[model samples]
Target: MTDIFNKIETSFRASLRGEESTDKLIYVWGIISYVLAFLLNKLIKTVHVYFFGTTISAVLICYFAWHIYALKKCSPKKPKLTKEEKQKLREEKRKEFGKKLMRKLLLQESFTKWDPIFISIVIDAFCIAQFIDYIIR
Candidate 1:
């Protein structure tokens, strides 16, 4: 029992190490939770709603919580440029590609970074709605 608990603690700490680990942990817990929920719903044949609802909610909560932690912990890198360097780059871009193209490129760069976070937020919202439905029904 002590060995088992120690192993679990080690695994949990490793999962907290980075975004990748948290992401993998989310998938693992989601699958495990769903399987347990299904087993309880099928075998016990009672309290199915409770088991399924709680399991789903717990998984979502775990995912979102870890996601927020990962986001907070991993700070975005600062732009490596002085004011003069930035001005030179802006002038060069304007001369080479025009201001309109520069704006588009910047937008695309930011969008790529933000896209996953936006999608995850939408998913979290959907999960919350489903959890509410599970509770009400």
Candidate 2:
């Protein structure tokens, strides 16, 4: 567990250093999606695998978001905004946050992550298959 976290933390720092989080992030979530998918396949007997899937998907979204936020909070930093621009930026962020929250809540199959679209597609396809199988069975 600590090792997993340490790896992600290292990657997170690398991202702050202007490095990409491609393998670091996608591999981490790929492992997560695999384990979670396997568990849901064998253990969970819920009606909607998407329920657990969506929850875990939201966790991944939040993980990336929090990592970005932490990076922004730590690095070279940005120029201080003027009062007007600050308010506008804050409001824009609030709106964007609401939209993302809605997307996760809706379990939108069309959604894609900024960092890893293919990975998100693969994970979602696996989850959706589990869900459809549950319904079919």
Candidate 3:
């Protein structure tokens, strides 16, 4: 983790701050979303699931899963917002961002926001490792 943070700090200091320069931020988001997903999966199994009036393995499923919905509603325009329009848009964007944040935090929606294959591999490895730990412990 420290090494990853170090790498990100290096990347940020050397960044170009453009479209491609988003790689570092994307990388961090990838790590966070996947970790949250796996933990939430286990949490649901260990908490929410029960059978015959007893708690069962309820930590491995998602009920109200988070989902990511892209919003391009605020794309740049040659014309800027009027003050009232700006306030209204700010409120709307605030709500939109809050929902997205909750989804991301809850692992309901992934960073589908990035490369699927890489993300899937990371998730697979995470699951394998978790199963291994479960067996060993």
Best model per TM-score: 1
Comparing 2 with 3 on lDDT, the higher-scoring candidate is 2
**Relative to the unseen true structure, what is the C-alpha lDDT of residue 19 in candidate 2, on a scale of 0 to 100?**
62
Error of 2 at 49 (Å): 13
Candidate 2, lDDT over the whole model: 0.58
Looking at model 3, residue 55 earns an lDDT score of 23
lDDT tens per residue, model 3, 46-99? 663334112211222121111111011111224777999989988999889989
Model 2 TM-score, 2 decimals: 0.31
lDDT of every model, 2 decimals: 0.56, 0.58, 0.46
Tens-place lDDT per residue, model 1, 33-86, is: 445545633543455767665676566556556545553344344589999999
Q: How far is 16's C-alpha from truth in model 1 (Å)?
A: 3.4
Model 1: lDDT of residue 125: 56
lDDT of candidate 1 at residue 44, scale 0 to 100? 33
| Superposed model 2: Cα runs more than 4 Å off | 1-4, 10-19, 46-120, 125-137
TM-score pick, better of 2 and 3: 2
| Model 3 steric clash pairs | 42-59, 44-58, 44-59, 45-58, 45-59, 45-60, 46-58, 46-59, 66-108, 66-109
- Show model 3 residue runs off by greater than 4 Å: 1-20, 49-137
Q: Name model 1 segments beyond 4 Å from true.
A: 1-51, 96-137
Error of 3 at 107 (Å): 38
Write down the RMSD of all candidates, one decimal each: 7.1, 12.9, 15.6
Residue pairs that clash (backbone atoms under 3 angstroms), model 1: none
RMSD of 1: 7.1
